[model samples]
Target: MAKRRLGGGLICGLLLAGSVLAAPPTAVIIGTPPQPDWTQLTPAQKSALAPLSKDWDSMESVRKKKWLGIAERYPKMKADEQNRMQERMREWARLTPEQRAKVRDSYKDFNQLPAEQKQTVKEKWKAYLSLPAAERQRLREAGKSVQLLTPPQPEPQVDESLAPAIVGESPASPGAVPQ
Candidate 1:
């Protein structure tokens, strides 16, 4: 069979959907650096990209482009987290083409949700997760929107300005002399 194709948008959407289903972390954690290129990857790493490898020859362009984005934002993750990610990658490789297609479709549906409805669903889910199943079902019957919790952003800090010249050293100062 001819190799299957996956669009960049679909791939990104799938990753986003996967992130949404991920369990909330009690503490924030850094993620691992992705293998920058196939050549940089180990045999096990190649295994992680398996079923997709038949298409890999044609897919390298997409892989390189996506991996570069990952590399730039990548942080050094704790070892245990790295191991878990590797396992996930292995399982991701095992997904059948049809399963992948279904995931992509689900992602498309999620993306189509209205912003307000999405927020309501998100709140509802959080509230539901905290309640008994009967209470959650009641809330579910009420029906609300849902959206994924956004990944955390780093806090901003003020930019440090260069030290200004001392009063006597600079031409801009009132008392400084010109040559």
Candidate 2:
């Protein structure tokens, strides 16, 4: 009986240990970070994100988080890359909501293109960018002119009096002629 009791207790202990080992780990709860006041920004972050200052407080949390992430990375970027980012931010700030939406849609569509097609587009853009400023401006002006020239309209409605002469047929009736 003593040996049996010891075996039972050992089995119970084994079962309890197994159950404890199988239990899930405790969840680690991470609290959302509070939004930073404009004054709280580092000088470098403030300079990098100057274009967005006016609307920063009203920005959604996700957007704020993204901007903050970018700001944190800015100091580490090469000079040219940082300048390009600043230029892009300025341009983005200037865009209207509709224009921004169009850009986002265009970016999504571009990203969905096959790799070969994307490469071709990237090559074409690189070629365009390589052109001189004056040449680019001239190309833009030429495109504007092409767009401004409207396509020819369909033939105008024929006057009933003139229809007889053109069609070689008399008007069906006096009522047929428009006022």
Candidate 3:
């Protein structure tokens, strides 16, 4: 009878442990975070909050909270810094989920590029934008002929697998000649 009682106690102890393990976390691991009250933020967070109102009800709780925190803290930040942060928040709201994921994945690569490369890309884009509509159309039409005139790229016999890692970068550097 003592052995049976001990076995029953052990089973109850195990059941209790399982329940404890299954209990909800005191600290949330994921999902949306909490948003502070909108009234709590200072002037900058208030400004940031202004553009957010339209979408606030639909935003993830964490993001909503993050914006509220921004409002709370932004009063101490410089005007320029606050404005830039606000712009980023605004842009974040504008992107679709797929676009946001793509940007999230490639953002590190974009951030890693040097200033000169960034400038080069900007200059090329500006030039492309500045060209007249007719000229742009002409260039697109010419591209087909240009491709036809180009010689076939012969595969090199060199075993790149056996070759040393080339220290050089790709030809597509943002600021490099947009060839």
Among these predictions, the greatest lDDT belongs to 2
What would the C-alpha RMSD of candidate 2 be, to one decimal place?
14.9
TM-score of each: 0.34, 0.55, 0.40
Model 1 lDDT per residue over 27-64, tens place: 96655534344565556545445444544444445454
Mind giving the per-residue lDDT tens digits that candidate 2 earns over 112-135?
A: 777776776677667766879897
**Candidate 2: segments with Cα more than 4 A from true spot:** 1-34, 37-40, 141-179
Candidate 3 lDDT over 98-178, as tens digits, reads: 987887766675566677665655666577668788877787687843343223444677666544333243334523332
Global lDDT scores for all candidate models: 0.56, 0.77, 0.67
In candidate 3, stretches whose alpha carbon ends up further than 4 angstroms from where it belongs are: 1-44, 108-179
* Number of the top-ranking candidate, with TM-score as the measure: 2
Worst 10 residues of 1 by lDDT: 144-153
Give me the displacement of residue 144 in model 3, in angstroms.
18
lDDT of 2: 0.77
Task: List pairs with backbone clashes in candidate 2.
Answer: none
Arranged by lDDT with the best first, the candidates are: 2, 3, 1
Candidate 3: lDDT of 75?
75
